[model samples]
Each structure stands twice: as C-alpha cells, then as structure tokens.
Target: MEQPWDYLRHNDPAAAGILDALANDRTLEDIDRARILTAVDHAAHDLEIRQRLTAELTTLGSAAALHPSGLRTLPGTRFATHNMLAGQVRLGRVVPTANSALMRAGDFGIDHDVLRTSLMVIGPPGSGKTRSLAIPIVEHLALASLAGKASLVVIDPKGTDFAYDDWFDITIDPLNPTHGFSLFGGATNADTAADRLTAALLPPNVSDDKAYFKDASYNALYDCLAPYHAAYGAWPTVKELLALLRASQSVHDQVKAALKGTPGAKEWKEHLDNRVRQSQGSHDPAASLVERLARLDRPALRKIFDHQHRFEMRDINRPVRVRVAIPEADYPEASRVLARLVVSQFVQTASAPDTNRRIFKGLVIDEAGRYVDDYVARGVQKVRSNNAGIVLLTQTLADFPPDVRPTIFGSTGCKAVFGGVDPETADHFSRWFGDEWITQNTVSRGQTSSITYDDRTIFTRRSGHSEGHTQSVSSRRVERARWTPSDIITAVPPGHALMALATSDGNRVGPMLVNLRN
Candidate 1:
C-alpha cells in the first residue's frame, strides 16, 4: 500500500525529490500541483533532466506572465547585466518557435563584451532604434555609474531627442557661453590646439583638390598661434584667433618676421606664401578658409569657444554623466564643429594608457555618421583595451561616406538592425553576417497508363504515382538575413529589432528577433 511517491523514491530518487518539493509547497494550488506533476512525469529520467525540469517548473509557478507588448529581458551573463535587475543568469521566456507571433515575449540580446568593441544601430525614422536600444543602453550605463562601475558621455546633436536631463550630472550647452565647455581643453601644445581648431572648421564633405587649402590654413593658424603660445605660455582664445585671421598686411609681415627664427616657422611661411600666390588666380584659398571659420564668430559660438571652464578628457573616468548638447537647427556649422571636437577629445583620451582598466567608459553618439572621421575610426580600432565602448546610431549606410563604411563596419563587433532599412544596407549586413548552407526540399509527380487486348472496342485504364523527397544540398548560400532589407523596410513593426552579436573570435551568434522593452 505504498504511495506513488514512495515508489519513485525506491526507483528514481531524482523524480521523488521533485515530487516532494511540489507536494509540500504551500504556494501552489491543487491545479498548479497537478500541472507540474504532469510535466515532471514527462521529464523524469536522468538527475540532470529532473533538476532542469524542477527549475522550469519553479519559474512557471512564480514568474509573472509577460504582456503581449512586452518582451522578456535578456538574462545577464558574465559580460552583461540587466540594467534594472540583479542576477548572474536571467533566462528570458521568449522562444523562437517557427510559428512564433510578433511582439511575443522572447529572449534576445547582445553580449556586453561585444559592446566594448563597438556597436552600430541602423533604422529609418520612427523605428524604435533610439527608445528600445539607445535609451536602454543609456539607462544601463547610468545604473552602472551609480554602482561605481562606469561613466558615460552622450552627444546629442539634435538637442531635443534626449530630454532626460536628470540622468546626466553635467550638461554642456554649445549655444550658451556661460554654461559651455571649452573645445581646447587638455591640449598640451599650440600645435595640437591649432590642429583641433582646423579639424573643427574643415567642412564635413570636402573634395581632394580642396585638401591643400585646409593644410595651408592649418599652417597659417599654427604659425600665428605658435609665437603667441611661446610668449604667453597659453594658447590663443577664439576671438584672438579670429583677430589673427583678420590681421592687417603690416601686422602679418611683422609676425612673419618675428617667427623667422622659430622652428617650423620656415615651412609655415612657405605654405602661406604658396596660398597667397594661388589666391591671385581663382577663389582665394586663404579667404575661403577664413570664411569657413567665420561661421563660428557669432556671439553664442564665440562664448562656447572662449569659456573658461574647459572639459577634460580624463573626466570621463569619473562616475558621472556628461551631455554635449548641440542645437543643430539653430547653428548647423557650429554644431558640426562641436561634435567633431568632442569626438577628437574622446579619442585622444582613450588612446592614453590606463593601469586599471576595469572601469567601463562609454561614448554614445546619436546620428553618429556626421561625426565619424579618421580619428574616430582609429579610436574604435584601439579603444577595446581601454575598457571604453562606443555606440553609434545612424539611419542607413548612406549616412556614412563610401570610403569610411568599411572601417566602421569592420571595427564594430555588434550590429542591431531595426525596420525600414534600404536594400543596399540590408544586403551589406546580410553579407557581413556571412553565409551558410540549408536543406532544399524537392517534390515530383508522375503517371503511367496502359491499355490492350480490345483495340476494336473502347477500353481504357490509367494509373498514377507521386514522390516527394528532401535533399541535403551543399550549395553555398547565405542564411536568410533575419531581417532582409525588404523585411526591415516593410515587415518590421515598431518596438522590435533584428540583432547580431559577435564573439571575440569574430564569429556571429545570432540574427534573432528581439522585442525591445520600453
């Protein structure tokens, strides 16, 4: 007259332990116990199997049900943690069944380590790229800051998108003088300062022939600033630099004569003389440089450049949030220059040596394509060792120039593709994710009939047979991109994205459909 539990105890101890736990649990109702017992019966075999079943049963019993609009959070691993939750491994409830429904709960996420290498997020307007991906990232970094694990810097060129002012400790308004940060901070020498200023003033899209003018302008600025720095032990202000650019002919001659004996001055003089000779023909190259820089001569921008409180690159290592807000609509040229300056500064800081690299630092650039240049590319290539991460957001591959697209794609270890992407961009991601072979199923049908004996009479008979088969074809093929460019353009709904995470060895883990939690 032994009970069923007793029978299991004598034969299968694993099963018996699960049964005892379920039966003795006070929280589970009779119906819940019955359901769990049925599942346990189906899974009762090896000890490992029983333990896994018990864990799942426990989850089912106590876990909150997911809403239709909600996607289960990605469980934390050694590389990444849930921003709001604390746990070593939090398994998501979403399963990728062949017939899975849209917006259903699912577990999909990129590794935190991959993020350190770099990340690119692309989607058209209103694709939830910012909310689902960027905002969550920012919140996670903020949480990490509070925990003393990381620091963050965000560049919001548009200004209006990031309204969460409370999340940041410092807000730099490039359009306001009193509350702005200096672009020339941390420059060790006059040459460095002049180079940064030149880069900021250079046009975003410039032709090859025009490159000489930029170099010549840089030389002129350097020649003027070098003597000033030597005499005063500090670099010139924006107003002072402008004054040098507007110097009278006699003043230019006097400064040139003064710097005649200085190192590098001879080369600078030659560049200036060449620029002057060239200006005698078509458009004046030096004048063009002056006009371009003149855009920053306005009151608001001048205040930003002349601000006394300069921003230091090393400040990013502290547990704080720094936001560089650029009012693009009001001052597009100045905004671009500020963005470039910030990127250059961050790159310079990241390139420095660090004794303890455990503290993570992040740079989040919204509309990043506008700011990416050779310096940023080089930084992405080297920042992984410094415990720094960069998150770049853009609408499409077209947002980047043709030459730079490869460097950006090659350096980034993680890519998240949202909906409404063009085919060209989708195809690029498709190829980047690489290719695989798949089974091709083929079906065929045939019929044969015969009639004989009485040709004189009218008699007929027919028979037919059908055949179906699946072939394991070895044709080289691309695994269908989780979301084709077409799929992104037409099929992807809001709040969901297709993500591909890469390992350290450069192997891709998934192009899974992830439902972003708002």
Candidate 2:
C-alpha cells in the first residue's frame, strides 16, 4: 500500500521534499513544512518569473496565472507579516495606559516611521467626533507634559463640551476665556471684551487704500454683535443697523434740504439758533441724534459704538485655555465668530513661542467645518508657521470650501476617518488610499441525469456549464486599525472601516480593530 506521500511525490515533488524532511523528525510539530508548502504552491501557479516577482513585490499573487485569468494582478491586499507582528507587540496594554499622553518609540512595523504629524478626526453628528479627536489630543497633551513637551489649548464650541478640569490644570470660562493670562480690558461685559479684542487683533482691512470701517465692517459687526448676542441672547438685525445708518445720514440730509427748500428756512434757523442760546449753545444736531437713539433703545449702535474694550492675553509660557461661548441659545453666527477669534488667538499666541523654539502647542477644533470661513481657513493655513499643530473635525467633504480643502487635508498629515453614511464622502476618502475596482467572471457547471422519451434507454449522463461575472471594490492595501466606536459598541449597526497609518514611505499599516470608549 502506498502512503499519502506517494500522491504528493507524483503530483508535487517540492511538497514531497518538505514532507520527507519532516518525516525524519515526525515528533516535530513545526511550521517549516507548511511554509515550504505555501511557497511551493504559490510558485507552481506562475509560469513566468514576472508573476512571481510581482506577487513578491505586492505580497499577493494567485496560482496558475491563467487558472484565474491571463490578466495581470496589481498589489492588492498585501501585508508584511513581520510588521504586523511587531505592531501587535508594541500595542501591549495600550488601553490601560491610554489615559494620559503615552509615547512609544520603536519600529511599529516594517519601515514604519513614528507618527510625528498631527491627526484630524472627522465624523458626522452623533458619530462621536469629540471622543475620537478631542480625547486623543488631551491624552497626547497630558503625555507630552511628562516628556517635557508643550501643552494643549482646545478651542471647544461650548465651555463645557470637554471635561479635563481634573485631568489637567485647565481653566474654562466661556464668558471670560483667555489665552495664557490675558483678559478683556476696558470692557464692561464679556461681549464687549470679545468684540474689542477681535477688532484689535485681526487686520482692519485687506488693503491700505480701503478704510478699516468699509473693509472690515462685517467682521467688525460680528465682533461687536457676537458678544452681545451670546450674552443678551439676540442677533442685532443687519437690516436694522443699515436702516439706522441710512436714517442718521438721511436725517442730516433732510435738515439741509428742508433749510434750502423752506421759504421760512431762515426763520426756522433763527428759531433753532434761539433754542441753542437758551441752552447756552450746548444743543447741537449730533446731540439731538444721540438723544433720539438713546430714547429709541437701538441695540445695534449700543453693541458696536458703545463697547470699546481691549482684549487681555496672558503670558506666552502659560498653558493656553480656551473659554468657549455658552450654547444656551442657538448661536450659529456667534459660534462661527467665536470659533474664528479663538483660532486666531491660539495661533498668534502659541505660534511665536514655536517660532522661537520655546515650546510647542496644539489647537484642537471640534466641528470645525461648520465655523470655518475664509478668515478661519487662512488662519488654519498659517498655523504650521507658528510651530503648532491643528486638528480639524468635520463630517462631510463638502463641509470645507474647495480651495481650502486640499490644504486642510494635506496639513493634517494624519487622518482618523470615522464611519460616514454619505457614499460620496466615503467614496472620496476611499480614493486617498487608491482603491482598485475588481471584476470577476464566474463559470458554473450543472449536472442532469435523465432518460429520453422513446428509444433513449437507461444510460443517463449529466452536464451543464454556465458562466457569470461580478465586480467589487476591494482595497489592495491592508492596514492596522483599532475598532472605533463608530464601527461598533454603541448597539448600533456595524460599519466597515479600516484604520491605517500612512507611513512616510506611503505604505498603509493597519485595519486593526480599535475600541471606542463608551
């Protein structure tokens, strides 16, 4: 009787060699024979050395290049066994030691570089963008302090969105937030202070020829009005402010027109002149207008013209604390304005130290796409020059302006993409890793046994062949990713996402399932 090895010898001499080698030490339960088998099996399928080399380079190839198809295969679903094992080892006790910033410096995978760039986390509403991005930033900041690195200044939308008062010595005052140790000076209220500082810090106009009033009027209006709206809970009507301006100018013009048109204009002027004499020349048209505005209780003039305050800044060395406006009322405009102001302040204040190499700081903005305008976008673009990092959180790709999108995406360097429901957004992101479209053709064989009608006697044979094709989107790249909350653990439906670190050499490292803390 022939042993199982006889069939191997006839069909695969290479497999027989490895099996014979293992037989000498039958007690050995080693993978050496399996490795040899796998290699041989793979090599046998490729007729030319080209397919084998391609497979080696891409880390994937099929047996019998034509058994599958004559078509050439690209690098897809490729992985480095050595790096994955290394990453598994480095990921030891990551969850337990995840509270504060923890730095592990070693080769996480093959040719893998350390993560030196800032990471941006983006997700839709209720998708936990705050947990994924802000928490990581806080953790990194906490860990950096231990490493003798700089701290973090998070520009949160609300004063209470993030809870780190006990974790790190943080100061939060939505009404009175300041960078370093600066506060609003010469301001009666929080709104006035924020307005004053915004006006003072940002450039008044785009050019020298333009008046600051004309050029920065909208921003100025935002600066002045945002605080009042945030504090008093109302938006100063734009139409109303415009109406007041027009009314003031109109009143002056009307008085001039009335004097010119009236036959008794000289008499009226004499009457006003007599009144001025009665008040000892104290009465004037400007005074009269002021009295009228005061009596009418115009909030527009009160917010801007009445509030002239100076913003306060603390020391450059102090830990940056952002006091976000309260979210008591739905303040979208206030949110946008305040977000821009805080971002500008963080960049200017922290950047100088970074340029001097004194210390590094990080600015974290959650839901950034909602608030970012041309002004905020420009500020975000310049953050790197200040020697600081920025993390912008958004859900949709369309959240950002087209021109600013590339810069924001490129600057992020590291991106943590959570699950997205929007297929367009998903497809857009899928392209970054270079997804390959796979098309497959299938052939089916069926068997039928039956006797024909009259003369076809007993013998029956079954035979049938059928074919079909299929197409799919499969990523050639395999990455190490942690299971995110968006992926699972919320009692919600599951989502498909692969976490990866895009190394400096442009290789992805994971699909490592990570857990998002509830």
Candidate 3:
C-alpha cells in the first residue's frame, strides 16, 4: 500500500513473480521500475488491479503493462479489447517469409510512443485491415481513454464499424438528431476555422494550376467569418455562410449596415466590392467551393451542420472518446466534406499552443483516402510532435494524388501492407522497404575441344581428337528488395500483413511479415 514493492512482496502470486524475475538474470533500472509502478498505481486503486500490475512488473520489467486498460474488462474475439495495461496493444506476431528472415517472431504492439509517429495502413477490402488493425488499436485507445490516459475520435464513414456506444462519450450521428459535430469543428480562431473549412470545401485541384482561386476562396470565407465572429462571438450558421459565399446582394447590404463604422468595416466593404466584381465575370472563381458547400446545405444535412448540441474538436484533449459516423451511402460528397473538415480541425486544434500535453490524442479514420488533401498530408508531421497521432486506412495507394503520396507516406513513420495489395502499391512498399544484401550463387559450365598428333608423329597422318567438359560454382554478394513487389503481392498469407514500425524516439522495426490470424 505505502510502497509498491512492499505490497508486491506480501502478494503470494506477485512474490512468485519476483522470484521469476530473479531467475531471469535480467532486470530494469531503478528509475524505470519506479516509473512503471507509479503509472500502475495512478491508473488503478483497485487491490486486484494493483496485484496484477505487481505480477506483470516483476515478470516483464519495463515492458510490463503500465496499468489496467479500463475500469472493467470486456470480452473480445476477432478484435481484442484487453491486455492494454502496459500502455500498449498487441496487434499480431511477426512471421517469416521466403524473401526475409524472422529476426524475431515478436508481437507488434503500439502505444502512445509508437502512435506519436502516426500510422498508415493500406489494403483492399476484406483484407482484415479494419478487423485486425483498426479495431484493435481503436479498442485499445478507447480503453486507455477510460483509464484517463488518452483521447480518441473515430471517424466512421459507414456509420457502424466503430459503434461501441458505451465506450465513446460522444456518438455523432446526424440521423439521430440528438447528436452532431460542430460546423467548424470547435475552432477557436476565426481565421483558422475559415481556412480549414475553405480547404475542405474546395476541389482537390484548386491548389493545382489555378492556385489563386484557392487563395481567393480562403480570403472570401475569412472576410465574412472574421467580422461575423468579432460581432457575434460564434461561427455563422450554415445558411449565413452560404449566403456570404454566394455574394448575395441582400446579405451584403444587411451585413454592411450591421457593421457600419464598426471595427474592420472598411475592409469588409472592400471585400464585398471585390466579391461583387468577381460575381460579374462570366465565370466566378468561388463557384466550385460554393457548389461543395451547397451539398452540405441540403435538407439531408443542414440540421446537423446547425445542430445545437455537438462535440467540438477543441475538446478532444480532455480525456474524451468520440465516434463520428458519417452517412456516406446517402451523401457521399457531404460525408467526404465532413471527414475533411474533421481532419483539418484536428490538425489545427492539436497543434495549438494550449493543447494539453499530458493527454494523448488519437484520430482513427476508417476510410481516409477521400479526406486527405494537401493540408492533411502536410499536417501529419506537425501533430505527431504535439502528442497526437492519426491512423489512416486506405484501400489503395491510387486514392492519393501521385505528387502527394510521398509526403503522406513519408510523414507516417508506421506503415502496413495487407495481403492482395495491387502490384503498384506493393512496389511502393517494396521500394520503401529498401534493399538488403544476400549471397547469390552462380554455376558455370563449359566444353572444350582439342586435337593431338603426339605418339604417332612419324606416321604422318596419325591424329587424335579429344573433348572435355568442366563445371564450377561461384558465390557473390548482391542486393535485392527486402520485399519485392512479387513477394509482397503474393507471399503474404491471407490473414497476415506486412508491417514496419517506428517509435517516437526513432526506434524502427519491420518490412517484416505479421500473422493477423492469431
């Protein structure tokens, strides 16, 4: 009770664990042992949980469970929701393959440390990516959240995959009417909220040839949002923002009158002038972004956008777990918009100065391809250092633009490839896995012909012909992909995946096979 070791010494099972530790001839340093003890003690005051921690600490040392996963345990099968006490979750064990050695058939576990580096899992449908990887990790994080160590947000496009209602404090389902997400994702800064929404609402190619249009769209939204927030102290309603985006004459008149001689009034008037000027052209640059927003303003979604009670991204660092289920089937484009908005808002809020450093934050997007724009890809590297991590699940590498693929892949330190991935995607993984040196054998064979007239030289025409055969074996060093495209595409078992992991401190493993079945 007073001292953890003293408590452990009195526990017969835990005492047996100590004896086992002594038998191993290895031990953790005093500081590490103390840290583990303190984490365990703080996470649970239950006598039984403490005894469990004592046994685990004595047996596994530094790798022991840090604490109980949650206040209570739950049953699990294809997806596991237990054994997260160590601040880590076991994914699967490494497997040996024809092209690689099993350095160790160790289990792949991810905790806040590994997650701080972010993870990108790419595989086709029915590849066990969702069941084996996402579900386990999300389940672990949720349990960790209940232990008061993490905050989690799961964006479920299908609206059912991550529906553990009891585990999540917030279930954002628009169809339910009782739950929703903030229109601006609870952004504190007006311009930041404007920018995030602008990024999401615009087309993917807005930042391509006509980059000015992207800038204009951002500026256009900011002009209306800043003054409105300065006046009303809140984000504008979806209808109000829509009217502003369309540059309607009546809305501008009402806004101009409302802000006459107010702060930023002159700038607001100038932006209105430019908006009117832009609207006069045969083609308005803001048309594309407006079209996207109109999709959200429809009867199917406007209420949720304007929902009074909703979860905000700014509150994610408060030991909360939220599951946002988007109705992608009925509103495909709107769902993507919502997903993109969540990504943008998360990046902004998590990177802010006031974000809680002690609470680990995680975002798991079941199908993240459509939501990943240039902004999201670039922001991945920024948030990892801020105690936030994201798990991106994609069906194919082709979902990302060719130019941004490297940025996305490079930013995420942890990567996984499931069985049956396309050759091109496998090739990408193959190249990323790099090359290793191995001994290659070469067998050489040759035939020789010769003529002799030795013994019967005097007999003028006496001659002989001889033929000889020779063989030799030689070995040389050569470099080959650790996991070639062919091997990556074919060798991975049906219920396994290829994984590579890197911790926050630069520790890395894999380009190895992992058996997911077990």
Query: TM-scores across all candidates?
Result: 0.67, 0.44, 0.78
lDDT of residue 311 for candidate 1: 64
- Candidate with top lDDT is 3
Candidate 1 backbone overlaps, count: 3
Encode model 1's per-residue lDDT on 1-518: one tens digit a residue: 44344545665665566567656778753324433443344344456755665565446532212211122221232222353322011212333522122335545554346667788999888887777777767766655554445578899877766647356666788655445565554677767777776766666446889888777777767756666565445666666666566554564565567666677677656544553455465655557657777777778887776767666666776555778898889888778878888887776666567512555678899999888875577678688777787999999988887778888888888888876788898888767655443323222213322322112112333335434432221222223344445655666556666666665456665665666642
Task: Output the better candidate (1/3) by lDDT.
Answer: 3
The candidate scoring highest on TM-score is 3
| Runs of candidate 2 exceeding 4 Å displacement | 1-116, 146-148, 168-170, 175-332, 350-358, 374-382, 385-387, 436-497, 500-513
**Clash count, candidate 2:** 23
Task: Give per-residue CA lDDT, model 2, range 1-518, as digits (tens).
Answer: 44344444664555455456554765542222232233344444554543353343233322212211122211222111222211111221112211111323223221113232345566667776575435545544433322223445565665566654433444433334332222232234434444534443334324556443332333333333333333334333333333332334453233435456545555544433433343343433223322332432333223322333322332324333333433324544434444555565555554443343333456667767655545445555454544456667777767876766766666555565556435555555455534322222222223434332122233455456424433222223323212323332232222212234554334544433333432
The CA lDDT at 220 in model 3 is: 72
What CA RMSD would you report for each candidate? 15.6, 24.6, 9.9
The candidate, 1 or 2, that scores higher on TM-score is 1
Q: Write the per-residue lDDT of candidate 3 for residues 258-371, one digit (tens) a residue.
A: 777688778767776777777678977777777888888876577677877877889887767788888877888888888888888888788888887777899998878778
C-alpha lDDT of all candidate models, in order: 0.63, 0.41, 0.75
Q: Model 2 Cα displacement at 424 (Å)?
A: 2.3
TM-score of candidate 3 versus the correct structure, residues matched by position:
0.78
- Supply the TM-score for candidate 1: 0.67
Clashing pairs in 3: 65-86, 66-85, 66-86
